[model samples]
Target: MKRVTGIGGIFFKSADPKALGAWYRDHLGLDVTDWGGAIFEWGGADSAKGMTIWSPFKQDTTYMAPSTSSFMLNFRVADLDGLLATLRAEGCNVVGEPQTSEQGKFGWVLDPEGNKVELWEPPAGE
Candidate 1:
């Protein structure tokens, strides 16, 4: 049998959740419901949402307060340039420039809480 499908939602405790949510909306332009926790609708199974929650614990670090996860969540995107441009225009701290590796074109964006959020544009045939 096949494994799970994809991530559904990521629920983390933010020090200032309101500000964090606003940051996600202002920078990434995600559809933040509750006025702040932005949700990006990923295309997958209708049942996929029920089957998976992408808030998998970071393997590299042991559990502590939810805030210290030690790694950022990554979202695969279609248009990296446009998104990055918009982020820059919004005065966001887009770090280290965009890097292309075997994985794909990747970059990092810092949230209001200073957590690094990674964005990737997958290569062809992915």
Candidate 2:
């Protein structure tokens, strides 16, 4: 079972999300949108087109909860259910159940260092 195929997104907490986003837009030319983030699209030599999201959340947000880490990593997976079961069998700290949305199917797990990791299986043809 192939686990993580690629990074789906990178999310981190910021003291001032607006200001920080603006800085990234102005200085780094990240094309930060009004929602305070950017989507990067890529196509590998032998891979299908894919996207990776970059976003920052307010410092007080509880999205990365159950872990005190300032950031969470979202990984793209081929099979969310199968990989999650494999992680559980391997004694990994898998968290929560899988969820489906227009964007994709999502799940969460905590690493040994207590960092919350998000797993995503994007909708077909995405």
Candidate 3:
């Protein structure tokens, strides 16, 4: 049995939720709503389109680390360098250096709430 299809959605809790949402909207040039949340449209030129909804999940459970919160948000991107440059220009705290692996290319950035968002550049010929 082939399991379910690709990732349907990802939801995570956040601190300073409003600030986080606004940051994504401003720096990333995303269509985050005024009320703040992201609804993504997933489709390559040759692939069928699917909708992705994102929001800051409400956290009622205990923190995952000694002082850190639970969960992080990762976004797959095409132009990693461009995006990273833009993020840095906006004065975002870019954590760690960009890297490549068998899966493809990867980079990380931390949000205001200290959530690490991963950016990925898929391998060619996908």
Candidate 4:
């Protein structure tokens, strides 16, 4: 019943995503990828290995839609379905149906402040 294991990613809106990513890459020494993001890997082979993503989106992007917040927090979850169910039963503001992709499974919810929160369940061995 582990609701959240860790932070999966941090996404925010930027006036110019490409330039912003470059700034971070140049000034902060972040290895921003071509896709305009960076992946920070952690944990040991003997332990549970995981990654946290850092990315920026265009100001008009609708990815973080339904939320006017400048930033969005993505949390890693061990069991997306189970936790989503629990959240719904607890009167939480769970958003649309879950989605799956090569990255993993994703779900959404809105906090009391109306900020959109993303829940992710990574594929096995990731």
lDDT for each candidate structure: 0.69, 0.77, 0.70, 0.77
In candidate 2, which residue pairs clash?
none
Could you tell me every candidate's TM-score relative to the true structure? 0.67, 0.65, 0.69, 0.65
Global local distance difference test of model 3: 0.70
Candidate 4 C-alpha lDDT tens digits along 64-116 = 86888878777677789987887788677788899999999999987655667
Q: Which candidate is the best by TM-score?
A: 3
TM-score between candidate 2 and the true structure = 0.65
Model 2 has an lDDT value of 0.77
lDDT of 4 at 18: 86
Model 1, runs deviating above 4 Å:
1-6, 39-41, 44-69
- Residue-level lDDT tens digits of model 2 in 7-118: 6666666677887666445423467887888887688888798777777899999988888998887767788888788778867778878899998999888865677878
lDDT of 1: 0.69
Q: Model 4, which residues run further than 4 Å from truth?
A: 1-42
Runs in model 3 deviating more than 4 A are 1-8, 44-67
Residue-wise C-alpha lDDT for candidate 1, range 64-123, written one tens digit per residue: 223355657777767888888888898887776788989679877777776777888877
